[model samples]
Target chain A: MKIYEFAQAPNCRRVRMFLAEKGIKMEYVHVDIGKGENLAEDYRRRDPNAKVPVLELDDGSHIAESVAIQRYFEEMHPEPPLFGRDAKEKALVEMWTRRGDFNMMFNVGMCFQHTTGFFSDRMRVFPEFGEESGKKAVQFFSVLDQHLEENRYLVGDYFSVADIGMLCSLDFGKAVKLRPDPAQYPNLVRWREELNARPSASA
Target chain B: MKIYEFAQAPNCRRVRMFLAEKGIKMEYVHVDIGKGENLAEDYRRRDPNAKVPVLELDDGSHIAESVAIQRYFEEMHPEPPLFGRDAKEKALVEMWTRRGDFNMMFNVGMCFQHTTGFFSDRMRVFPEFGEESGKKAVQFFSVLDQHLEENRYLVGDYFSVADIGMLCSLDFGKAVKLRPDPAQYPNLVRWREELNARPSASA
Candidate 1:
C-alpha cells in the first residue's frame, strides 16, 4: 500500500501516528501542499476533495479521510487495536475521536486557514471566523482537561485513536498559537506531555 | 436503550434514520434545544458537549456523536448493514460519511448558526461567515451531484450511512435555503428525490 500525505498536516500526522502505533509500514508518497500539487487533476482523481492523507491499497483503490484510513488499517490489523476491543469500547473510542475532531482538530484547522490565509489562493478566509474558531479550540481544552483529570486517556485507561486524534489536534493547535495554558488546564497540559513523549509522537 | 435528541437536529436525525432503517425501536427522550434544556447541568453530564442524539445504553452509560451511536447500532444489529458488507466497502462508506460531515453537514450547520443566528443568544454570529458557509455547502452539492451521476448511492449501489448523512445534511440545508438546483445539480436532485421516497426519510 502507498499513502499520499503531506508531512506536518494534522490529518496526515494522524494516519502516521496510527501506523507507528500498530508497527505497520507502507510506502509513503508525499503530496506537497506547499506547491499546490494536491490540487492538480491527477491528485484530485485519487481524492475528489483534493485532501492529503489518502491511502492507496495494492488493488489501486484509494481511501480518503484520515479516520477512515485508520479504520481500514484497524480492520486489517486487529492486534493492538486503536479503535476498541468490543462494542461499548468501540463506541467510547469513536465518541472521543469525534469529539477531538469537532472540538479541536476542525476548529484549529479553521483558525489557521481563516487567520493565516494559508491557502487563501484556493479558498476564502474570514478573519473573524478564524479568531472565533481559535477561541473555540481553546475552550475545548478546558473540557478535555476536566475529562483527563480522572481518566488516564481520552477513553479511560486505554490508548486509542481518540488519544491519537487529540495529539494531532493539539500539535496542530500550535499553528494558530492555540495552546492550553498550564495554570488553567493542568490535566490537559500533563496529558499532552505524556503523549508527546510517546515514540509515535515523532512520527 | 434511550436516545436523547432534538427532533429537528440534523445529527440527531441521522441516528433516527439509521434506527428506522434497521427497524429497531428505542425509548426517545426529547431534549428541546430551542428551550435551552440541553444546556442544563444534568444534560451536560450526559454529554459534555451538550449536543443532542446521545444514546444511553442499557448499562446506563451513554455514547455521544451520531456516527458512534450508529456504530453501536450497527454492531448490535448486523442485518441490512448500513456501514458495509466487507472491508473495502466499509472504507468507502466511511470515506463518504466523513465527506458528508465535512463538506456538507458541517457547512450547512455553520450557515444556519451564523446566518439564522438560531443560537445567537449563546454564541457569536457572523453573517459573512454564515453566507460563506452557505456558498461552500452549495459548492459541495455539485461535488455530490457528480459522484451520484456515476453511483446509485454515496458509496456505491447499496445504501449506507453515507446516504443517511447526505440526506440529513440536505434536509438541514433547507434551514439555510441551500438546496441543489435541478438545473445545476441534476444528479444530486435525483438522488435526494429517491432518498426522500424511503420510509426512513421521515425519521
Candidate 2:
C-alpha cells in the first residue's frame, strides 16, 4: 500500500502523524502540489477533488481525504484506538475532530491560500476572505483554549485523532502567521507544548 | 434521548434525516436560531460552539456536530448501517460525507452567511467572499454531477449519511439561490430528485 501525497501539506502530515502514532509505516509517493502535479489529469482521476493524501489500498483502490485514510488505518490497527474506545467517547472524538478539521485547519488553509496566493494559479484568491479566515481560526483557538482549560485532550484525557488534527493545523498555522497567543490561550499553549513533545508530531 | 435543534437549519436537518433513515425517533427541543437562541449562554453551555442539533444522551451528556450525532445513532442501530458495511466502504462513505460537508455544504452555507448577512449581528459578513463561496459551491455541484453520472449515491449504491449531508445542503442552497441546473448538471439533478423523493428527505 502506498499513499500519494505532498509531504509539506498539513493534510498529508495529518495522515503521517496518525500512522506514526499507530506505529505503522507505509510507502509514500510524492505528488508535488507546488509544481501543480496534483491538478494533473492522472492525479485528478485518482481523486476527483485532487487533494493531497490519497491512500492506495492493496486492491489498487484509492481513498481520498486525510480523515478517511486515518479511519482506514485505525480500523486495521485498532490497538492504539486513536479514533476512540467506545460509543460516547467515539462520538466526542468525532465531534472534536470535525471541529478541528473544519474550523481550525480549514480556516488556516483558506488564509494561506487566499493571502499567500500559493494556489492563485489554480483557484480564485481573495485576500479579504483570507484575512477573515485568519480571524476565524484564531476564534477557534479561544474556544479550544477554553475547552483545554479543564481537559487533558480535546475529547478529555485520551490522545485521540482530534489532538492530531488540531496539532497539525496549529503547526501549519505558522504559514499564515496565526498562532494561539501564550497569554490569551494558555491552556491551548500548554496542550500544544505537550503534543509537540510527542515524537510523532514531527511526522 | 433529546435533540436540541432548529428544524430549518441544514445541519440540523442532516441529523433529523439520518435519524429518520435509521427508523429511530426522539424528542425534539426547538432552538430558535432566528432569534439567536443558539447564542444564549445556556445553549452555549450545552454546546460551546453555539451550534444547533446537540443530542442529549440518556446519561444527559451532549454530542454536538451533525455527523457525530448521526454516528452515535449509527453505533446504536448498526442494522441499517448508514455509515458503511465494512472498512473499505466505511472509508469511502467517510470520504464522500466529508467532501459533501466541507466542500458542498460548507460553501453553500458560507455563501448564505456572507451574502445574506443572516448572522451579521453576531459575525462579520463579506459579500465578495460569499460570491466566491457560491462559485465554489457551484464547482462542487459540477463535480458531484459527474460523479453521480455513474454512481446512484455519493458512495455508490448505498444511500449513506454522505448523501444525507449533500441532500440537506443542496436544499439549503435555495436560501442562497444556488441550485444544480438541470441543463448543466443533469446527473446531479437526477440524483437530487431521487433522494428528494425519499420520505426521510423532509425530516
Candidate 3:
C-alpha cells in the first residue's frame, strides 16, 4: 500500500498515527502541499480533491478521506482494534469520531482555509472570512475540553481513532492560534499529553 | 428508536432517508436548531455536543452524527444494504461517500454556517469567515460536477449511501444559491434525475 502524505497536515498526521499504532509499514509518497505538488497532474489522478493522505492499496484501489482510511485500517487489522469489536462499541466510536471531526477538525480546517489562504489559488479565493473561521474554531475547542473532562479518551476508556483524529487538529489549532487554555481544558490537556507520550502520537 | 431531528438539515435528512429506506418507524423529537433548542439542557443530555440527528436506540445506546447513524442502521438491518458487502465493495462505497461528503456535503455546511448564520445564537456566530466557507462549498460543487459526468452514481453502478449523501447536499445546496448548472454538469443532471426517480431517493 502507498500513502500520499505531508508531515504537517493534520489529516495526513491522522493516517500516520494510525499506521504507527498498527505497526503497518506501507510506502509513503510525500505530497508537498506548500509547493503545490499535489496540484500537479500526477497527484490529481490519485485524488481529484487534491488533499493529502490518499492511501493507495496494492490492488490499485485508492481510499481518500482520513476517516475512511482509518476505517479501512480498522477492518484490515482488527487486533488492538481502533473501532472496537461489537456493534455498540463501534457505533460509539463512530459517533464520537464524527463529532470530533465535524466540530474540531473542521473548525481547524476553516481557520486555515479561510484565514491562512494557503490553498487560496485552488480551494478558497476569499481571505475576508478567515478571522471569523478562526473565532469559531476557538469555540469548538471549548466543547472538546468539556468532553475530555469526563472521558479518558474522546469516546471512552480506550484510545480509539477519534482520539487520534482530534489530537492532530487540536495540536494544529495551536499553530494557527486556536489553542485551548490549560485552565479550561485540563482534561483535554491530560489526554493530549497521554497521546503525545505515545510513539504513534509523535508520528 | 427515537431520532432528534429538524427536516431541513441535511445531517438530519441523512438519517431520515436511512430510516425511511430501512423501513424503520422511529419516533421523532424535533430539535429546533434555529431556536437554540439543541443547546438547551434536555437535548444536550442526548448529545453533549448539542447537535441534531441523535439516534437513541431502544437499548439506550445513543448514536450521533448522520454517517454514524446510517452505519448503525445498516449494521442492524443489513438488508437492501447501503454500505456494500465485500471488502472491496465496502471500500468503494466509503470512498465515494466520503468524497461526496467533503467535496459537497461539508462544503454545503460551510456555505450555510458561514453565510446564513442561522444557528448564530447557539454558537453559529461570525459571518466574515462563514461567507468564505459558503464559497468554498461552491468550489466543491465544481469537483462533483466533474465526477458525476463520468460515473452513474457518486461511486459506481449502485445507489448506495454516497448517492443519498450527495442528493441531500445538492438539494440542500439550492437553498444557498449553489445549484449545479445543466450547461456545466450535464451528467450530474442525468444522475440527479435517476436518483430523484428512485423509490428511496426522498427517503
Instruction: Name the top DockQ candidate.
Output: 2
Candidate 2 residue lDDT tens string, A1-203: 99999998998999999999999989999998988998889898889888999998888889999999999888888879998888888899999998988888889988999999999888888898889889999988889999999999998899999999988998899998898889999999999999999999887
For each candidate, give its TM-score against the true structure: 0.98, 0.97, 0.91
Candidate 3: Cα lDDT at A36: 97
By how many angstroms RMSD does model 2 differ from the true structure?
1.2
- Worst 10 contiguous positions by lDDT, candidate 2 chain B: B71-80
**Higher-scoring candidate on DockQ, 2 or 3:** 2
Q: Show the colliding residue pairs in model 2.
A: none
Please give the TM-score of chain B in predicted model 3: 0.90
Q: Is the docking of candidate 3 incorrect, acceptable, medium or high quality?
A: medium
Q: Which pairs of residues collide in model 1? A: none
Whole-model lDDT for model 1 versus the true structure? 0.90
Per-residue CA lDDT of model 3 for B92-164, tens digit only, reads 7777787777777777776676677666655444455556556776767677778777777777676688778
Off by over 4 Å in 3: A120-128, B59-61, B120-135
Per-residue lDDT tens digits of candidate 2, residues B1-203? 89999999999999988888889988999999988998889898889889988999888789999999988888888868999888888899999988988788889988999999889898888888889889999988889999999999988888899999889988899998998889999999999999999999887
- By TM-score rank, best first, the candidates go 1, 2, 3
| Model 1 TM-score, 2 decimals | 0.98
Deviation in angstroms for B192 in model 1? Answer: 1.2
